[model samples]
Target: MQDLKGKVILISGASSGIGRATAELLASKGAKIIVNFRSNEESATEVVYHIKEMGGEAIAIKADVTIKEEVNAMVEHAINSLGKIDVLVNNAAGGIRQSTFIDASEDLWEETYKLNITSVLLCSQAVLKHMIPKGKGKIINISSTAARIGGAGESIHYAATKGALNTMTIGMSRELIEHGIIVNGVAPGVVETPFHEKFAPNDDRLTRMSASIPIKRIAKPIEIAECIAFLASESSNYILGEIINVSGGR
Candidate 1:
């Protein structure tokens, strides 16, 4: 509906969940998609195959977003394969392993920062070179409500990294607006993604947690994808430096 046709877009962590949903939705609207995955080559290819089945253009590239060199190379591949990236969805993240502060090791905190915060910075920086020259672009970072409402007994380090990301979004938006690049963020709350099945395996606790939300349900992956799509579109031209909460009233 937003006429993303012919636009080139890159999505990290696109093997499954919200990233995968975003890829499918954007591809449906005719954007040339670059699916970035870390280790899930089969799942990544499946996403690409589905996009192509719908007559959409897409390619899957494996890259560890947390690593600067890999992220930079992925950006290059996306640009070379798709021409130029008009929209960059910084959806790559890796802080789902929840651990208490005292229990969290230095390595855990370090890894959280590298994946959740640093990756966003590197990916955005890589894309900005091309984006600025073109004089228009959109960058959407996927954050979490945990960033604001701190997950209890969970990884405080994870929440801290997300908060840092939100801050970076605000700062980057201020600096890049003059360059015609809009930077924004989406903070999702309790989205029902594959991460949950692995992280919260206790059915009883998971059910109780789901019921605790004001909406009494977890968000669908597609819902978050929809918001990402809107932010990446021209419809959000006037919205800048904003972090839209997709938390279902949480």
Candidate 2:
């Protein structure tokens, strides 16, 4: 395990799913966790409580990362409460509904971009202000395999936003690496999370999706969290601007 003692890590949308798992795993490695949740205060509290119960340090903060002002405030709170942020996990994102280009609405497109693409930009910019001064930090984005293979009939808008994010990850890394900040991303395949419950509600459909993967099984939240933790640690210092695929060979 990576020794992250004294490190301060901020994870957005950490109330549950991959974000929550990342927070828990990092806390176990001795990192001070700033759990950012938009609306699930109770779930966020539970995450912090569990971390504390394990003798780890954690605090939950509420913020809508899509808003610039809120993003700035969240970063400020992390710095003030934990001294400084050493790692930022941009895990706050959503795909409200699926629609094809022919049937997609303007509002859906706008909302998808705001949540998946704009939020990443806003959060990274806000945190970079603090990380730049220190001349060192880590930014790990949660991308998706859909970015490569367009979601097509599923969620084309969501796929487009993630594609933009994947490109931004590379661009941001090149822009920030000279300053000692490493930017990378993880593209997870079909994982068993609330995302599937919301997006693919049909059990049979989900089963077919899993069967299509080479592994023939959906990933656990902890599996993706482990990849995020690796990218956040010093072990990935030499791995700048790359997005690792945690997909089950989909």
Candidate 3:
């Protein structure tokens, strides 16, 4: 395990799913964790409670990451509470209420962009104000396999935003590396998370989707969390401008 004994890490949308998994995993490695949630205080507190029980330090902060003002406030709270952030995991992401491409409305597209793309922008900029000055930091963006495959016909808008994020990751990595801030991305495939339950097709379709992958099954949330942990570690110091594919041969 990477020794993150004193590192402070902030993860957005950490009340549940991949975000929650990342928080617990990073904390387990000795990093002080800031778990950011939009509206789920109870869940967020549970995450913090679990971390504390395991002898890790953590605090919960709430913010609607898509909003600039709230993003700034959340960052402020994190800095005040944790002293400094050594890593940022941009993990809060979502799409429109389930819809086929033809049925996806412009409003849905707008909301999805705000959640998936704009939030990354807002959170990154707010946190960079601190990390840039420190002259060294890590940023891990939670993209999706959908970004490369274009959704399963129902999440084109979400896919589009992730694609934009992929581009942004590369551009930002090149731009930020000079400042000693390493920016990278993780694109996860069919993970076993609530996100699939809410956004993907029915269970029968999901079973088939899983069967079709080369691994013949979906990934556990921790599998992706493990990858994020790596990017946040000193082990990845030589890597830059890379968006790793955690897909199960998708």
lDDT of 2 by residue, 1-250 (tens): 4788899999999999999999999999999999999999999999999999999999999999999999999889888888999999999888879887889999999999999988998999999998898899999999999899997347888889989999999999999998889999999988888987888889888888988899999999999999998988888789988989998999
Pairs of residues at least 3 apart in sequence or in different chains that clash in candidate 2: none
Better of 2 and 3 by TM-score: 2
Candidate 1 local accuracy as lDDT?
0.90
Best by TM-score: 2
Query: TM per model?
Result: 0.97, 0.98, 0.97
Cα lDDT tens digits for candidate 1, 47-98 = 9999999999999999998788998899988888878999999998867587
Per-model CA lDDT versus the true structure: 0.90, 0.92, 0.92
Alpha carbon lDDT of residue 204, candidate 3? 90
Ordered list by TM-score, greatest first? 2, 3, 1
Clashes of each: 0, 0, 0
Span of ten consecutive residues with least summed lDDT in model 1: 149-158
Give the poorly placed runs of model 1, Cα more than 4 Å off: none
